[model samples]
Target: MMTAERHFLADDVPDRVRVGVADLAVATGETRVTTSGLGSCVGVAVADPESGVAGLAHVMLPDATGDDRGKPAKSVEAGVERLLAELEAAGGDPERAEAKLAGGSKMFDFSGVSEGVGERNVERTRTALGERDVPIVAEDVGGDYGRSVELIPETWTLTVTSTHKGAEEL
Candidate 1:
């Protein structure tokens, strides 16, 4: 008798990804990823429909201004710009690039500071996309629960899943 035993490695996993708050993801197929535990943080997903190139960013703050100069551009503006640059380098059409924004939930209690961050993130993301002239095809921002975002490059489809509520297609 022969027993079947197999172990799948990280590389064997589909193009799936897991992104944290204030973080971003960029790839050209060969991976399907997912992100979790996003509270008061915003997630940005960009993709070039024609080229099948896509990226995602989980952001915590708006612009890196106050006491955040030396650090990297984890803010909405900087992160999106970085994502776009990667897409462009991959031969993804700048004009054809479409963006999808998600997360930015109020996970804390009545803490004003915590609640405010999510709102600011949403606004900043919207503003940043506008400035770059990247059209937002879909979004799911501002809520009471954290979200998990999934991006499929081949289809240019982004799906957002929440903890309490059911999954919503964006």
Candidate 2:
């Protein structure tokens, strides 16, 4: 893991390909992409099993609209697009991609709020993926907590971890 929140003292732990907040990455087999501190943020993982390629995105918002300020993965819409493009560039077929989603947790409570940012993130991600004709095969989303995630392309698994909840593979 490559985040300020967690560190491993053991040399046995595998080194990760870290995708920070508002970032995204595409990798082939034997590499895992990870992100931490998912509060009202989403981790979108896409895999092309036959091609042995995968992509992970740590999206912080719904849409970038006019400008992303140079951070392409800051929004779900742009993140999904960039992830697909990156994956395709790495020899992954976008037409054969399958998506898995994690995070999108409501870390804070606000009185009388109609909707949470977490929910919006999930919705936007679904919409973006759907528009691209990509199917979401798995999801772990929506709650009042924070989460960290790792996408292992070798296994086509997304390991979602939350302090309040135990870790699970999606």
The most accurate candidate by TM-score is 2
Q: What is the Cα root-mean-square deviation between model 2 and the actual structure?
A: 5.7
TM-score, one value per model = 0.82, 0.86
Task: Provide the global lDDT of candidate 2 against the true structure.
Answer: 0.81
Across 15-131, the per-residue lDDT of candidate 1 in tens digits comes to: 456554555556666566466766777778888888777777776677675653332235777777777776776567778888888877776778655557888888888888888
Highest lDDT among the candidates is held by which one?
2
Lowest summed lDDT window (length 10), candidate 1:
1-10
Clashing pairs in 2: none
Candidate 1 has an lDDT of 0.70
Model 2, 47-111: lDDT tens per residue? Answer: 88897778788898886767766666888888898888888877789999999998888777775
Q: Candidate 1 at 166: error in angstroms?
A: 1.6
